[model samples]
Target chain A: MANIHDVSKAAGVSVSTVSRVLNNHPYVKKEKVEAVKKAIIETGYIPNINAVNLKKGKTHLIGIVLPFLDVPYFSQLVQGISQAASVHQYKLVLYQTGYDEHQEKEALEMLKLKQIDSLIICSRKISLETVEHYQQYGSIVLFENGEDTPLSYTFIDHYACFMRALEYLYEHGHRKIGFSVNRLEGANSSQRERAYRDFLKLKGLPFHKDYIFKKCLNIEDGERILREIAAFQERPTAILATSDQVAAGIITSSSNYELKVPRDLAVIGFDDQPIARAMQITSVNIPLYSIGQILFEQAIAVEISHKEVSTELMERSTV
Target chain B: MANIHDVSKAAGVSVSTVSRVLNNHPYVKKEKVEAVKKAIIETGYIPNINAVNLKKGKTHLIGIVLPFLDVPYFSQLVQGISQAASVHQYKLVLYQTGYDEHQEKEALEMLKLKQIDSLIICSRKISLETVEHYQQYGSIVLFENGEDTPLSYTFIDHYACFMRALEYLYEHGHRKIGFSVNRLEGANSSQRERAYRDFLKLKGLPFHKDYIFKKCLNIEDGERILREIAAFQERPTAILATSDQVAAGIITSSSNYELKVPRDLAVIGFDDQPIARAMQITSVNIPLYSIGQILFEQAIAVEISHKEVSTELMERSTV
Candidate 1:
């Protein structure tokens, strides 16, 4: 029921000041902005952005397509997107693609039909070529796992991140090191595999085929891998996991074999998740949250290009 | 650019079969569904639903207002909603309200102005009265923590759930029991506290005000609370924590004080999260994913009412 006039009157500011604040224009005094915010809250004023969107033929809704939620990796990325979207005064629509091409097609359709202003593909099953084709319809930004795409992307160097983890183990006097990965085919895992092989070769270490562990997704994966290692006659002294969950699993399950981490089998993990800290597993801290924020920021732009976020190795008690 | 007819012809079925398959209609034979699916993929067909949405004057967008993501509680619920929404051909727009009244207001305004078809308040800062006020503008289904409001809600009986936990501990020959809750003022926690006191009095056990713990949101909260309890000369022999994260924290931190669970202090947790399983903490499984599915299914409907999901006590090693 309240209007700009009521807000301005309550805040003791001019109507133009209120307008500037609502439109998010710069150069407004801090005290005046705070006053306007307080007054808006007190008066319960909601500026009618729908009217503006209607006139501009824009819904001001951005679409984000991803596989799933609840996983800390994707959820943290989404959290960053949520924060950035709210700041920009834009709403985000999440399409749970779940690696299904049909579900992904619906998200692309939302862009082509002008239902959403732009599309940010966080994860997808469709090939790069298919997504590149949708670029003509609207801005399509990606969180790419590998190299640069034809369209705009935020790239994280999985190869470099994994390499850092391996080098850290080698520097800590580890000779025989094992590797754990979630998927063998994905861009991230593919690059990580390359890094593992390359790092071992460069360091003049023997490549143990049995040390290569795959499908290490959950904590069970870590435990499963550790159990296999415990039984093997020639087990590696160090391990690099694809996820913090896997690392945490190794720590908890290691008790069964009387293996103390760093003393018996040093372990390094990817993703600095809370579990990693709680379980005391060192990891390659990827800037996934920042990547989400940066990608969303660039995705809404009229013209955009590739952006890269680097990963840092976190030192902890594990190694 | 293959159409429905081409997909049907390729699959050896009529256009209706292909259409139904594309629309995800139930009752289709398994082989027929697989054949049609293969045909669609083979033909690279994409169904055009934009025209249908335009003609029906519907956006087919559902807004989900939650406090945050990355936490298992909300993330799991959103996961369920995302799965159900996709099945029903609706897109979810996320509003990470973060218990901010202004952010929640933005979501409510989205409903009032028809930006989204309906608003699903997963968590909110606004009172039930304010939400009830918005009911006139559009459908508003809530994930309420407290008592029933005038509007529809998907209730998880926190009081009954807590009462059951207390009774279980009492049955196990535990006279002194402590309680851990996140928010003290919310409806769920308030009811939980009342149940705790009522159950204690009924069992002729003395109520110790010092045993009540608050602000137990994360694992650290559990650890901090356990540290406080360790110093207490008259610490309870048992604890019922509101979350599994907190319970895990207590267990891990207890080792520092030379304490063992079940023998030293029995701990029962709420929410059967993965951490509970990893740490072997007995907890009340709230069936959050099903709650999400059922809530979203009802939130999209024209007529909505209150629905309650029961909790199950999962007996594990800790208890």
Candidate 2:
């Protein structure tokens, strides 16, 4: 019930002096700090942390911009980030944008408004140029490749990862290949698309628009992909999924559709999550948790830097 | 950067008046509000949201205490909560305690420190007595039955759900049955354990200590359970898994161990996630997302109330 002014009055010191003690300002005399502490106890004044954070200009809170939390990739990333943040005595403020531009902008504006110390964008819909404009407000870390920009980022080589997967499928005597992506406009998806086009050109294979399945992120989407392919005149024999969930969906429902995995359709998934391991779905190990930790570190770092994380192919039976 | 004092001096108003205008206090004069706005722009004073929040005694931040985010149940709940929070213009501050008592205490301290407006404990390790001590600070919402405590809660009737699942397995003619749990000491798990015991007693079946799988949560744990069952001379005919992830793990790995699903071991999982549907595993639907939304509503509500949510068994091929 007691305010800061009450503490100051009880301490027989100026309000500013009491504030200095509260914020642990080093310049304050030892005697004044003792007096403020005694006064705080005497008045039963509960210090609002927001007040101290206002004076210190540090909230010890970081913002994480992600499209969704139920997705394994983003959830895994959040787990990693959350673990690292707890170690550093920081907490995460989640901005679930669902790839909405306005929602993403709201997160960026929070940084401008000094609501959070820094921000980590796991995945985004806003343009790089727009994100670059907010760099002066606070440290903005990206989970995707922002190498060309002046922001800190930790990214996996989607182009190379896609190319490697494509090459693996190509070497296995498969010329007709297809892939799935959550959004066609995403930066990572664009790179993946380019890689697919280049891989097809290298193999002298024609590109089919129907082969590229958009909005394929969840497990049920895999069934949808199967149905779409079942209707096709000539379906691709080898398919690359955006996530293990989608691949798991395809394999699980394949039996119902009178199809056998690998024998009828070889399926490759990204993010070697637990699902991939359990189902034996060969996938690209993205190490999302580790990437999340790096993103958090970048968010709090003073210097702007960009680092590319490595990926591995976890070979299992589904492919 | 211009401070609040600068804005006040430029506006020719008292510092308290400037703060009142910034907080949109009803007592502030309309002319003074316009003057403060003009002065804020003129002085390039970006009102720090923390300062405004401090004065208003409202942060618009709700703390969520959870063990882990990578798990499907927790992640799905968070997704639901996040969506609801966004609709109400509130952001979530995640405190991933990993079930540590000390970490849980810190989240409670944040509530007492006025860092967050309310706290939503999805799951926890702390005692109800200790949690009750902080109710005067702000609203604290629980995702488990807290009927005895003076706190708001939205809980699933785990006891009834467990009983129903046991009876369902009994009706299917499975007398020798096993079950899995993440932690023996968890509140929900304790209720589930009691329900299992009661069901066994009602059916005149013996309880086996080895039948209870401890720390069984993830997909890999399902494989561990399978390995454990294979070693047993007298194996149970059916198993009740803690989660769909665990059931999926068991079914996925069952093929490797020469075990056919329902024919060999009828498995029933909880929290009918997408993985459960994809794997055709019979599971009890917990509806975590809807519960999450209710948890958020309870967190912001002023009065303390407890509500029990219903569950259903999704009859799939595995059973």
Candidate 3:
């Protein structure tokens, strides 16, 4: 109920001094800061955050648009973002679109409307033009989508990682290989699919259309892929899944059919989630936390310097 | 950058009319709404969200104080919250505490500063007194901690879930059962431990402290519990884990030692996540998404009526 004027009167300081103390500005003298603090405690004054955000012309809020937060991959990325944002004294606003196009549009509209200062898009549902339009308002950072655009990004080279996984499988004497991927709508999934096709062609191996399985994201999708493999007349000896959680599903489902991994079915997955390590599933370990740190740095830079940034990859044990 | 005055002038309407249209007041004419919409589109007018929030005396931003966002349980709950919040046109502010007391305090402070409209305390680290202070500013919703308090909460009956799982194991002729849990500091974990001890006592079976393993909240923790079980001089025939992910870990690790499930070891878990069905790990199914929905309803009711709201449980699968 108490206003800035009341705090200023009580503290025996200028309104600007009270504001500085509230904002934690380093320029304010310790004595003035103490006076304002005392006044605030005594008055039970709660500064209006909306007014503060308006005065600053920016909210220390970052928007994170992800397809599904329940999954391990996005969840881990969110964890990274959370840690990075906390360290930088920024809050994260989550937009869980569930990979819906309309939701993506809505999220972008919020960004353009200045509801959020900047956005870190982890999902691949939005078009490049949509991203560019939103970028005019503030920074738009991409995650796992390696599309070349004006917007900055932090992503793993999915093509390179897929190729590496395939080569490893080939070297390990896996002649017949199959892959399970999510629907090839997002730029990231498309890249992984392209890598799979290219790797098979370059190796002079027959690319069977039946070997490729597409489904929704998650562990259940992986289990469905396993069932499809089991129903195949001629099943592949090795499988490369899109995610570690999916690989876990395959490995667990295969056990039900008396198929032992590495002996009967060698399986590999992407994103070295905690489950991957616990299950000992071979996977491409992307530095999710580092990506979060990089995105946060770029977001801060884009806000402060008004410049675009780029992406980098940190590899781990999956390949 | 255009304010309501600018939009009103461009639309040839009064500022009050524009405000009425913006607030969706029934008194506003359709013709005036159309005119305002056209002006908003043509002039690229975006509402100052901060100013609107200030006028309402509420930010419309709810802060969720979670340990981590990447975990499936929390993420799933967040997904539910996201959908529910979206329906009510509220945005989520994620405050990842990572079990740090300092971060928890900071999040509460932010709430006190009116940065967030409501506080959802999902962390097990902070004490009840600290949470009670934040309740003065806005509604505080507790998740998975059912300590009887004046606060609104959404939590599963952990004691009931644990006992049911144990009863099932006992009925199936499994006498020696080991339990794996996360930190005991968590209210849920403490309840589960108590249930396990009480069940053993009620069954006239000796309870062994060595059979209970406490570790971090992840699949690796599950695997660690299995390793501890493997090293036991007298291994239990059945295991009850705090989560399905942990059960998956135990199953996967047991497979490495050629230990067949059901025949060699019977494992049951809690929170029957998606993987539980795919892997056939019998678990206690908690309505995680419904919990989110309930929390949202409670938050909205508290915001609108300034009254306390409580929680209810919806059962699904595990047992």
Specify the highest-TM-score model's number.
Answer: 2
lDDT of 1 by residue, B1-319 (tens): 5667889999999888887877789999999999999998998765543434433446678899988886788989999998899888888988898789888988888887667778888877687778888886667888765345656688888778888988899888899899888778766788899999899788888889989999887778888888999889998899998798888788877888888898889999888987787777899998889989987887788776778888899999886
RMSD value for candidate 2: 2.5
Q: What order do you get sorting by lDDT, best first?
A: 2, 1, 3
Task: Name the 10 consecutive residues with the lowest summed lDDT in model 2 chain B.
Answer: B46-55
DockQ of each: 0.24, 0.86, 0.62
Residue-level lDDT tens digits of model 3 in A80-196? 888888888898998878778888887788787677888888876767787787777778787654446776776667788788878888998987898887777667778888998
**What is the Cα-based lDDT of residue B6 in candidate 1?**
89
Better of 1 and 2 by TM-score: 2
- The candidate with the higher lDDT, 1 or 3, is 1
DockQ computed for model 2 against the true two-chain complex using alpha carbons: 0.86
Please provide, for model 3 over B1-319, each residue's C-alpha lDDT reduced to its tens digit, 9 standing for 90 to 100: 6677789999999998988888888978789999999988877777877878777778778888888887778888888888898888787999888788888888788787777888777665988877786778777787755455677776667777778878888988999988887787688888889899899889999988888878745777776777777777888888887677788788767866667887888888777787777767777777778778787777767542222223222232222
| Clashing residue pairs, backbone N/CA/C < 3 A, model 1 | none
Off by over 4 Å in 2: A8-14, A20-39, B5-43
C-alpha local distance difference test of each model: 0.83, 0.92, 0.78
Write candidate 1's Cα lDDT for A1-319 as tens digits. Answer: 5777899999999998998898788999999999999999999876544444533547778899988887778888888888888889888899888779888988897887667888988877787888888987778988875244667788888888788788888889999999888668766778889998999889888888999899887777888988999899988999998788788788878888889898999998888987776666798887777888898888788776777788888899899
Task: Point to the candidate with the largest DockQ.
Answer: 2
| lDDT of model 1, residue A195 | 94
Candidate 3 regions exceeding 4 Å error are: A1-44, A144-147, A172-176, A255-265, A303-319, B1-47, B145-147, B255-260, B303-319
